[model samples]
Structure formats: C-alpha cells, structure tokens
Target chain A: MLKINGKPADAAGLTVAEYLARENFDARKVAVEINEEIVPKKNFAEVVLRDGDIVEIIGLMGGG
Target chain B: MVTLEDKFTLGGHEFTSRFILGSGKYSMRLIEAAVRDAGAQIITLAVRRANTREHENIIDYIPKGVTLLPNTSGARNASEAVRIARLARELGCGNFVKIEIMRDSKYLLPDNSETVKATEILAKENFIVLPYMYPDLNIARDLVNAGAAAVMPLASPIGSNRGLATRDFIQILIDEIDLPIIVDAGIGRPSQACEVMEMGAAAVMANTALATAGDLPLMAAAFRQAIEAGRKAYLSGLGRVLSRGAAASDPLTGFLHD
Candidate 1:
C-alpha cells in the first residue's frame, strides 16, 4: 500500500517506471518525487515503490 | 538615440523586451500569439499535479527561444516553496524560480517573510530567485540581501485588474533597489504598464489584463507598444512640469497678431 499523490495504491513491488507506464503518464512531461525526494528520470527504472511510500508526480501548467 | 543594444540583464540573461507575459487564465492555443504580440522574452509558468486525463501540456505551446519563469503559487511556506522550485527545475525548464508564498487564499497576497526565506535558500542552490512580494521597502531590502535577482512588487491584488494601487511604494522600490524592479499583478491596462515603465520599472508582467480582454493578442500587442514607448520616454527623459505658472512652448514675443 503506497500513497501516490495522497491516494492509497496497491503498487508495492512496482518500479517507478512501471508505475508511470501503468498509469499512462508520460515520464518526460512529469517529475517524480518519492517521500519528498526527487527521483531523477535515469533512476526511474531501478527505484522500486515500497509500501507506505509517498509519491508525487508534478508537471508544468499555465501560470503567472 | 535608443538602440537595440538597450537591454536588461536578469540572472545573467539579457532581454530586450521589457514585457513579461503570464501564461495563465487563457487558452493554451493563444500563448504563442500572445508571446509574439507582447514581444516577451520571458514567460511565467506554474507547477502542479499532472493531469492523467489530459494529454495536452502547456510547454507544447510555448515557442522556442523564450525563457520560462516558474512560480511557486500554491506554497504556503519557505520549505514548500523550495520543494516546488526544485521540482520545477527537475522538469528541465531552467533554474529560474519566482518565489510566491501565499498563506491567505482571499487576497492572494505573498507572504514576504517566507518569500525572503525561500529566496535565500533557492539562491544558495544556484536558482535565479525572483520573489513576488507586497510593496514594502524593508522587505525589498531584505530580498536584495537574500540574493534575489529581481524584486516583483504587486500593484494590487492578483487578478484583480485594479491597476497600480501601490504606485508610490513600487516607485520606492524602483528608486532604491539595485536589482531590476519588475512590476507584477493588478495592472489592468496598457496605460498602467506604460506608466510603470515611465517610472523606471525594469519590466511589466501581466496575465489577467490580456486574459480578460476582448482580444488577448491585440491587447498584448498594445502592451508591447506601450512598454516600448514608455521605455523610450524614460530614456529620452520626460519633460518638466509646471509648479505654479504656465510655460509656453511657442514664442510669446513675436505673435502673429503682434
């Protein structure tokens, strides 16, 4: 049970890359953070999502 | 004569256009047109939770060669602002971050102290910090001491389109602060932008003015012309005003009737 974007998810053994692919998120368009630390794009394939880990996926938006 | 060589340097980048456009409250399709019409070299953007449902992204619309200035609009404290800034950088936009820490949701006024703190931290990390702050002299001084690249003072509440309610204080920052004074927020019209430029502001940033206009691209062009006109006026030096008596521009000694 991992918290991805404040919601509980059942992804306990998936790598960050797998989670992003499953969720249909373009890895290039979004930045990933696990438990308040940024996960660089190169490490997405190796970093695994553990239970209780918090994930935040952010992207650029219209702003002033 | 003002030449093309006249430019303002921000965070080691030189910009000839003094109008900074905001890419909010409007359609993404209009961004390119607005940027072209406004002649803006720098534009502002926000970072947020990526929408899984939508495939379109704002970055897809921005034209090439324009610099991105991402803001921390949702952060309520220094740490939160720092996190947002780091995330914005991770997105590969650039190192420029506009520190906008706001605790109040109503007026959306920036928290100056938190902004100062964020500026200090981000500047230390090599981020070109541009803190949007309420018009206060002491805080502007503090931000300069905190290693800010520029000080953005609001003319009024954000998105209000009230137009330069904080004129005198903004003028103070322009007069005293060594860094570039980019007037942001509540500038409703091209005239207001021109007024600030004439007051020696390094640049003018607006979003709601164009967003709410009947024609966004046209208004953006108007703002561009007004900013350029005002910059030229400032550079050429404004004419003096009369104190008590009227000064005639024509020769009084040799009138046509006389």
Candidate 2:
C-alpha cells in the first residue's frame, strides 16, 4: 500500500503519470512528491510509485 | 524640484502598487475583480493537496501580469516550510515564496524563528523569500541577515480582521529593518491600512478586510486609495503634531477683531 496524500492506497508499480490519470487530476495544475522528494514534471511518466511510498500531490489554492 | 521614484522594490522587482491582495476566503470568481480594484501587482496564494473532485484552480482566476506569491501556510517548522516552497515552485509559477510557518492553530501566529531559518534556506536556492513574522525587531534583523527579500510583520492574528494591534512594533521594524516592510494580516479597514502605510510600511497585504465585506471589489478599491494616500502622506512628510497646545491653521493677527 502507498500513502498518497496521507491516505493509504493500494496502487503499486504505477507511474506518477498513470496514477494522476487514474485519479482525474490535471497534470498541468498539480505537483507531485514521493517520500518528500519532488518529482519533476518532465519525469512524471518514468517515476513509478511503489508500495509504502508516501506521495503528496500539491497545487495552488486560495490563501493569505 | 527633484522628483524621486515612488515605487518599492522586492527581490529586484519594482512594484508601483503598494497594496498586496490575498486570494483567500472568497469566491474565485471575485479574484479578478478584486485584483483589478485593489490595483495589486503581487497576490498571495497557498499550496495544498490538490483535489481531483474540484475542477477549479486558483491560478486560473488570477489575471495576467500579476506576480504570484505562494505562501507556506500549513507548515509548522522550517523544514516543512522549505519543502512546501520547493513544491510550490515546481507548479510552474515564479520563484516567489512567502514563508509562513505556524505551529499554533487557533491564533495562526507565525513561528518567527522557524520563519528565519526557512528564509535562509529558500533565499540560498534563489527563491524570493518573504517571511511573515511576529512584530519583533531582533527577529526582523535576523531575517534580513538570513537573505529575506522583504519582511512581512503581522498586525494581528491571521484572518481575524482585528486591525493593527501591533502598530508600535511594526513601526519599529519599519524604522530599523533595511528591507521593505510589508504589513500583513489582520488589517480590517482602509483606515488601518492607511495608518500603517503612513508609518512608512513598504506595502500592505489584506484579505479578510475585502473577503468579509459585502462588496469585495469596492472594498478592494477603497484599500487601494487608502494605501496610495498613505504613501503620498509619507512621501510628502506628514504635518507635525503639537505635544501640548493646539496650533491654529489661521494666524491670530489675521482676525478682524485682533
């Protein structure tokens, strides 16, 4: 199981791009990080998610 | 008469508008109108977990030509703030990050020491770091030494709309700190914004003042005017106040009876 955004997920061996596509997240608007390391946009397709990975997908929001 | 330029520079970028608007606590549709009415060149944003269910993004509502200042709102420490800043930069916007490290949930006060640490790290990475801090002279100086482009001292608690509760301390930072002192948070009314600007604050950032208003765009415009007026007053040199006695504007000898 992978922890994506602090929630346990069953996704394993799925690339970041594939996970994003499966989740309906627009790739252009969001930034992905695995285990506290930023996964650059250019390498999204190559970076695969493994079991026990902690993933955090972030985006711009309204705030002060 | 020699005319000096009336603009403030932050991280080598010159901005003529002294009002910095916060894009929070309101509908995204109103952002464009508020930005236009506020005449803000720089606007603040937050980085958070992207929701796939929500189709709308805040970046979409921001008009063209305005600089984005992504803030680390949820971070509770220096490293957490740094990580958030890095992720925010990867989102394809510019490298401007507002360092807001808060450990407390209720008051939402910034952790000044952690903020300074984050500023140092971010600035070294070439990010334009603007650290929001408690109104303290020592920490402000430390931030300047830590490579912050500008210092943002809060007037009161975040989103409280309490006005300038830290007036005198903010004044101390404005007087001592070399970097631009941008007053942030808890400015409820246009008069409060004007008061800080008159005290020589480089700029003012507000959100709740407009977000809670019945008319956000109109309130934004009011803040813009007040900020400009205060800047002008600062530039023109405000009239001195008498300590004990009142001084009449009209001369005593000018009266017909005299």
Candidate 3:
C-alpha cells in the first residue's frame, strides 16, 4: 500500500487522476512534475504511479 | 561565442543562460515549444488591460515551472513602472521587474533621466529593477549608480532587426560597469546574440525578432545553442580580432612593431 500524503490510497495502484479525485483536487488547474519532466495535461489520466515516488504539484493563479 | 560562464541573479533567482525570451508572439504551442528549445528559465510577460477582460483565452498560454518575470513594458514612466511592478507582484507572485519606459511609439528609447530617477525610488522600495536603456554608456552607468539591479542596453532599437549596433559601447559598459550588463533589443539573429555574449555581456534579451520568425521554435533553439556556445567562448577568453588580411604570428618588424 502506497501512502498518499502520509495516508494510503484506496486498494489498487492509483493513477494520478484517481489520486487527485480521492485527495479532493482539481488536477487540471495545476501542473504535475514528477522528478523533473513536466507531465503533459493529457497524460494525467494515463500516468500510473508507484510507491515512494516524489511528486510536485504546482497550482497556477490569475496573472497578466 | 562567449566563454565567460556568466550568470545573473534577479530577486535571488539565478539564471545561467544569457538569452531571455519574451512571451508576446506565436501560438501557445509555439511559445511552449520555443521556451523548451530555448532552455530559458526566465519567461517575460507584460500586462495588458485587455487580458483581464478576456481571461479565459489568455490564461492557457503560460508554461509550467517557468519563473514568470512580469515586465513593466506598458509603463510610460518610473511612477507607472513602480505601480505596475506592485500590481505584477500580486499577479506574478514575484518582485522581479523588466522596466521599459519609452513613451513614444516610434524609437522606443527610454527616458534615461526619468529611468535613473525612478530606479533610485524603486530600489528604496525593494524592487529588483532591470531597466532597458539606449546605447548611451553614461546613462547605463547612471542607472547602475541609482541602484538598478541590472541595466539592459539596446543593441539597436526595439522591434528593429538590425542586430548588434552598440557593440563598442556595449563592450565598454560590460568591462567598466560592476553590475551585470544585459544586451537588449536590435538582435535579429542568434549569431548576433552569440556576438553579444562573446563581447563579455552578461546576457541578452530578444523578443520581436524571435516572435516574428517564420519558425519561432527553430529560432529559439538556434538562439539557445548560440548563447551556450558564446558563453563557453567568453569563459575561455575569446581571441582578439584581426583587421588586416595576413597571419602575423611572429614579430612583424621587431622593435619597430613593438
């Protein structure tokens, strides 16, 4: 069982989409960069995860 | 090519690449592609009142993880630049600013006196100012003296693709000035940027030329390679220029040549 911000995700290995849904986040409004490469917005649903992977999520705010 | 291995810092953010790109042209896809190809850590954005009204169409263009450097491009003076900088801080979440204060549409040369005056005030307010200036070396020194974080001297004129027109003065500014010398404007080609870097400039900023290119992504990649090559050359100390035709490796006239 992999931890989700210190808590384990539900049962099976969760895709980033499933993880975001479970964690109450709108994944589209933010960007996900795992390790270094920025995951394309379209890949969010297809990107499966493993245990102990470090994910950095950055949210974008309104700007000029 | 430059081999100086030069790096510049803005608001504590360090950047190794000497070529900075503007966020004004091409499609969102091209902008994204060019940024990746350019290897630019700093992506400059300007405020437009129209964007606020059309928020949805504009918001999608921003790239992920890029250090959003909001520029005061529309500001007519230092006072306006300061206000715009403050507002951009709220929007960009950063205090770094690119100050452009030319009022006239033709000849986008900055109002040097006002810029120096404004830089002093902005410095007091803790703003990291990078003012775009004319080819004037004295004005460049004055801006630096007035607490400008960095001074950008135009290579020719904004939006004009004449290339590095201020080479001689740019060299002097870079050699004599303590602060970083960033060459801006009039860079029509990547080779020109390489030339600027080779001349000991800390960095170069290009927009119109890249944006107007038929293949902006390709141009950006070319610029990226050129900047790295130039920086490497500068770091290793570029060989001096030879004006006359003929190799004079040894003493040309013994004591007379000396």
Candidate 4:
C-alpha cells in the first residue's frame, strides 16, 4: 500500500533498504525521497515506509 | 591586470578557471580526463529517475573535489525547474543549478519570464540559480533582481553549433547587466568560445563543441587555452578599432625608413 515512483506496491512496515532491495535498486546510486521529504542517505536503513507513503528515486544522467 | 590565479566568486563559491564544462553526449570514461585537460573547476550534469537496476553512475566518473553543477534540462516552466533543482540538491550535490526552462521544442529557446520566476524561487531557497535565457538587457536586469547568481545567454539555438548568432543582443547584455554573463549554447569551435570571452563575457560553457570533437581531451585542452587567452586579452584591455585608418605597430619616427 505504498507508492514507489507513482506505482502502488505493498511495502508498508518495510524499511527503505528493504523496499529498495525488493525493487532491485542499487541504493548507492539512487537518492530517495519519502512523502516529499528527502531522506538522507545514512537514514535509508532506518527510515521505515508506511501505507500510502510516496517514494521517489533520483539518479544522475547525461546533461549540458 | 588580473593574474591567472585571480579567482572569481559565483554564489559565494570561488573558482579560478573561467571555463565550465558541460557533461553530456560524451563517454563517461573521458569525463575526468576532459575536465583535467580543460583545467575546469566546475562541471554541469543532469538528473533523472533511477532505472532500478545495476548500471554505471555518472557521479562515479567525476573526479574528486570538483563542483557538480546540476542542470534542469527537462523542465518546461518555473515551478518544474524549481522542483528539479530541489531534487538535485537532495542528492548531496551542492545547490549550484543551471536553470534551463525551455518550452519551445523546435527552437529550444528558454522562456525568459519563466526563467526569471524560477530564479526568484530557487534563489530565495538558497540555491545558486544560474538561469539560461535569450539575450535581452531588460530580462537580464529582471534576473539580477531575482537573485540569480549568473545569467547564461545562448549564443545560438541549443546544439546547433552556430556560434554567436545573437552577438549584438549578447553585447547589449554585457554592456548593461552587472552579473557574470556566461555564454552557454551553440558554440561550435574553440575560436568561437574565445570570441565571446574576448568580447567581455565573464565565462563560456561549451558542450557540443567538445563532445563531437575527434579527440575529446585534446579539444578540451584547446577550449581551455582559448578561454585563457581570451580572458587575458580582455583583462589587458583591447586596443581601439579604426575603420579607415591604419596604426603602425612601431612608432612612426623609430622605423628604419624614417
């Protein structure tokens, strides 16, 4: 019952690390924002996801 | 006279190199070498959503201790640009952003009004907002009033490699606006980069010119040298131009013929 990048997923009561791992995302290369608040990198393992929580994963890409 | 070691500040950050490199359309393997060859202290990058799989990260390719200037390339308006800038900052890359809010897909021209609006918001949020715009003195003034760190005016359409098609308009901005004017897009050659810098631009940012070159590192070095030479010439104070008269290099009375 959580939104990861606008798609609903059952990640309630899961830590950020578990959610990223379940989604097969390399946490080292992505930054996560939980419910419009940027969760610092160090807190990923400790920040637990709640029902209806929105998560955004940002990565670096080519640009000018 | 300003020495090569003389540094300038943008958004309270000091930089010795006037050249800023854009990281796009080039191999990530060459990014570090290109930056080193260019002697650039700052480089720009873009952000996007993660792919949710194992892949190479662009940030890993950048050298240590270099400033990462993230750009809002996909945003079509002010609020979108602001959001992108905030997301980029949350990634631990400092708050230096290149605000590129282009709504015109055909020409890829920045919407000046929206750019000014983005600058006002980001600047208030403590981001070092460097907004790209078409060269206009009044718009440049509005950006300055909005707390922009610098006003980046395109020399031509994005990725066109046309080289300073808007020279007169850019000149007006240089003559009128007080902020650091960085020439951003459509620069094809190193000489073109030199031309704008010599015309009193505070800096030059080149992407396609280097990305499409035969040798990326060598072309980067060429741009670095050209920018240095142009900045030196500008600091030395160029001589006046005469339309109908010729001025001899040597004194008239000191020549052998005299």
Candidate 5:
C-alpha cells in the first residue's frame, strides 16, 4: 500500500525503477520524488519502496 | 550589423538566438519545428505531475543542445516557487529557471514580492533565476539586487495577447535595470515583439500569440525575423523625433525641381 501521486498502489517492495516500469512510465522522461525528497536519476534503481511511501513523479509539460 | 555572433548572455550562458520560445498551449509535435523556425536556443517549459493515463511526454520532443528554462508557473508563493525550481534542477534540466508566481485568478498578475524572494533564494543556490514581474522600476532594481539573472517585465497581463499595454512602465525597466530585460507576456504579434526590442529590450518571450495562430511554425519564423529586425534597428540608432514639420530624408539642394 504505497501512495503514488496520492493514489494507493500495492508497491511494498518495488524499487523506484520497478514501480516506474510497472506503471508504464518512461523512466527517462520523469523525475521522481519520494516523501518530499527528490531521488536523483542515478538512484532510481536502488531506491526501494515501502508501505505508505509517498511518490511524486513530475515531467516537463507545456507552459508559458 | 548585429549578426548572430552578437549573442545575448544571461546568467553566464550566451545564447545565439535572443528569441525564447514558450512551449505552451500547442502540440508537442510542433515544438521542434517552432523552435527551429524561431531560431531559439532557449525554450521555456512548465513542470507538472506526470499523467498516469497517457504515455506522451513533451521532453521527448525537445531537440538536443537547446537550453531548458523551466518555469515555476503554478506556484502561488515564494516557498512554493522555490520548491518547484529545486525540483526542476533535480530533474537534470540545468539551472535556468523562470520564476512566475501568480495567485491572482482574474488578471493573472505576477506576485513581484514573492518573485524577488524566490530569486534571492535560488540565485544563492546557483540557479539562474529569471523572474517575471509587472513593469515597475523599483521592483526591477530589487530583483537585480536579489541576484536575479534577468528581470522579465510584462507588456500586459498574462495570456491577454493585448500587446504592450504598459509601455511606459516597461520602458522604465529597460532604461534603468542593468540586468537583461526580457519582455514577457501580453505580446500579441511579431510587430509588438519587434517594437519592444526596438525600445532596447534584451529579448522577448511570446507564447499565446503563437499558440493561437493558425500556423505556429510560420508565426514563430515571423517572430524571429521581427526580433532580429528590431534588434538591428536599435543597434543602428533611430533618428530623433520632431514635434512639428517633417524632416526630409534627402537634402533640399538635391531636389529635382530645384
């Protein structure tokens, strides 16, 4: 029961990379944050998810 | 004769093209074409929560070697803006940022005070902070003092496409502010962009005008030409204005009738 973008998902033991791949996100295009701290790209594969872990993914979008 | 070699430098980064294209309100597929047509070496973008349903990503469309100016558009306060800027850097988009803190819903006005605060914080963090603000000289000075890489004064309200409604106010920033003056927002046409550059603006940022246009690439090209033309004219030094009577371009002695 991990929170990804405020929605609960069963990701108790998934690495950041696994979660991204499972969710069908192109890991190269997004920046991941865990519990208010940004996880740099180099650490995505090693950073593991636990119960109630909050994940926020951000991407470059259209803006003025 | 200001060629592309006369590059504009902001925050220690020299850009060959002064036109900064905004990636907003347009299809991602058109971004490359628009950027190429505008000859923009710097492009601005906004960060948002990744869409869970769609696999589409705008970053994939941006060409390599172009600098990314990620903006804090949705931030309503200084701290929020800071968070957004930091996140953008962590995303590996580099340190260039456009601080836009707008809480006003009606007019969509930038919060200048918050912008200054964000600039002070981010500038110390080594981010090249470019804050958008209303055309006010005092605030512009404050921003410069706060280590802002550049001061962006609006021509009018955000997304209005009204074109330089605050001409005199913007002129003051251009006159006194030592930092680069990039005119942002409310510019409706290529001619308006040209007009501001002619008034000595360092550069211009336009989005709504191109987004709403029927032909985005064509409009981008138009803006590129206009900005170049205006910059050349400003470099050439415009002639003085007269209150009464016309000044003849050719000498009176050279007239055929004489």
Candidate 6:
C-alpha cells in the first residue's frame, strides 16, 4: 500500500503495528482524525494502511 | 459582612485562595515561583494517554501541599474521559478529575451532551468530577444531578483572553445551580481574574495570562492580590454598580434650598 504522512506519499506495505512501531508518534497523547472524524485509540494499530486517506493527529501543547 | 479569612469549599476540599492555577505551559521554576507567590492551593493539570516522557510532562511539576486537579482537556468523548479519570485513580495521586469535552478545535467549544455523559460516568465511579462546561445553567444543573463535585463554566472560549465573555450566563448559573461555579477560561489578565472573582465565582483558573507574561512571577503575584481583593469585595457586597452617596459632613439639604 502507498501512504502519506504529513506530506508526500511513499510505498508502504508495513502493517499498522509495524508502521507505528517504526514511527515515533506520541500515540497516547495524539488523537488521529481520519477524513474529519476521529479514529478510536484501540484501532490505531488494528486498521491497515491505505492510499490517499487524510490522517491528522493532534497532541497537547504546553498551554492553558 | 464576610471576613477576609473566609474559606472556599467545594467537593469537601477547602482552599484559602479564590484562584486556581494551571500546571501546564510554564517551566518548573516559573510554575513553582508563581504558584508559591500567588498562594494558589488548587491547581488544574491535564491528563493524556501518551507516555509522560513523550507528551506534556506535567507530572514532574506537581507541587507539594497543593491539591492536584487533573483535567481531561483532550478527550473527545465520554468514554475517553472516563478512561482517563480511572487512570488517575489507579495512579493514586489525584482522584479529582476536571472534564472538558472540546469536539471542535476552532472555537474549542464545550460539547454539552458529551460532557454530561462523561460527568455521569466519572461521578458514578466516586471520582470528584469538576466538569468544565459552557456557561449553561441547564447543563450545570444536569451535571450536579450526575454527582459532579463542582461546575466549571468557561467565561469565554478557551484561551481567548476575552475576559468574562459569558457574564450574563454565568450569573444565571450562580442563581440556579447549587454546585460551586468556577470561571475556567478566556481570562487573560489579573484584572480579568479579579473581576470574575468579584462577580462571586468560587474560583478562576488562569494559564495564558500567567505563562505569556514577560515576568511570570510578577504577573502571578498581581493575580494573587487581585483575587484576594475580588474575594474581599464579593464578601463585602457592593451596594450598587454605580451609585454615589455622600456621607454627611454637616447635613444634606438642611434648608432645602432647591
């Protein structure tokens, strides 16, 4: 599968677990919104990757 | 007339100050200095799922002798909020949970429906749920029914610094809701925090106003003095918004000249 993180799409056949294992995303502090709605935390590693899906993850900043 | 040493009590916690400080945004030294200078006993910190070292590492700054208040500021729904609250209990550091359900990012508006749901679940778990809600009287009442320790209504959108933007709604909350009402957000300055306290809010939480200052300690001390002044003013009870009554130096209209 082809995937894009933040910007460019790259050739990716890695499972969700493998990808997350490879990446350094603050999984506990980050919330992923796919196509505008949120993805459940439990499914972060279960859902396989696909091409052209917009995924945005937000984390807590050091503010009020 | 009320006195200066009056204590503010809610959910069985008694705090001497009318201000609540946030444990986010500032450095440990800054936070420590400001908190100590401000005499803030109640502090609000957020709980997130990420490992402490990776995300906002606020746990290290939990000051001694101050009550730790954990808020679910990032949780999108009731379930996530509940899970966070439970984790706090398991950690055995803080049983008090501050619930904030922000479904949107642009306005950071409170999702009243999901907040109520989370409050109910967390409260049932015997957690002292202090929910951050919109300044809605109806929802405040609902949260009280759900066993919330207190109701924290935003005076304005989070981090707006607009200052008491929901004054009228807040007054309504004070009138109708039995729970202690704490103005939680959009307070950008010491004066703003004071004004909210003077309006009879049990407490106010300030973050940006303190963290963004050129000198965080001085700003925090200013807020401390302001909060005390406001609390005192609230206790003394202002006679009217605007009314000038002159004291009798000799006599008023003695001869009725007019």
Task: Pick the lDDT winner.
Answer: 1
True contacts kept of 6: 0.15
lDDT on C-alpha atoms for all candidate structures: 0.95, 0.93, 0.72, 0.89, 0.91, 0.74
Docking class of 5: medium
- Model 1 C-alpha lDDT per residue in residues B9-113, reported as the tens digit of each score: 988999999999999999999999999999999999999998789889999999999999999999999999999999999998799999999999999999999
Number of the top TM-score candidate: 1
User: What is the per-residue lDDT of model 6 for residues B23-131, given as tens digits with 9 covering 90 to 100?
Assistant: 6677765667877888888777665434324533454555788877777777788987776666555444357888888889899998888999999998877788889
Query: What shift in Å separates residue B189 of candidate 1 from its native position after superposition?
Result: 0.4
**1 versus 5: better TM-score goes to:** 1
Residue-level lDDT of model 3, residues B121-182, one tens digit each, is: 87787878888887677888888888888888888988888997878888888888888888
On a 0 to 100 scale, what is the lDDT of residue A32 in model 5?
Answer: 89
Native contacts recovered, in order, as a fraction for each? 0.90, 0.95, 0.03, 0.75, 0.82, 0.15
User: What's the ranking of the predictions by TM-score, best on top?
Assistant: 1, 2, 5, 4, 6, 3
Better of 1 and 4 by DockQ: 1
Interface RMSDs of the predictions, in order, are: 0.6, 0.6, 10.7, 1.5, 1.1, 6.3
Compared with the true structure, what per-residue lDDT tens digits does model 5 show for residues B106-164? 99999999899999999999999999999888889999999998999999998889998
Show model 1 residue runs off by greater than 4 Å. B253-256
- For B135-210, candidate 2 gives per-residue lDDT tens digits of 9999999999999999999999988899999999999999999999999999999999999989999999999999
**TM-scores, each model vs. reference:** 0.98, 0.96, 0.72, 0.91, 0.95, 0.75
lDDT of 6: 0.74
DockQ of candidate 3 against the true complex: 0.03
Top DockQ model:
2
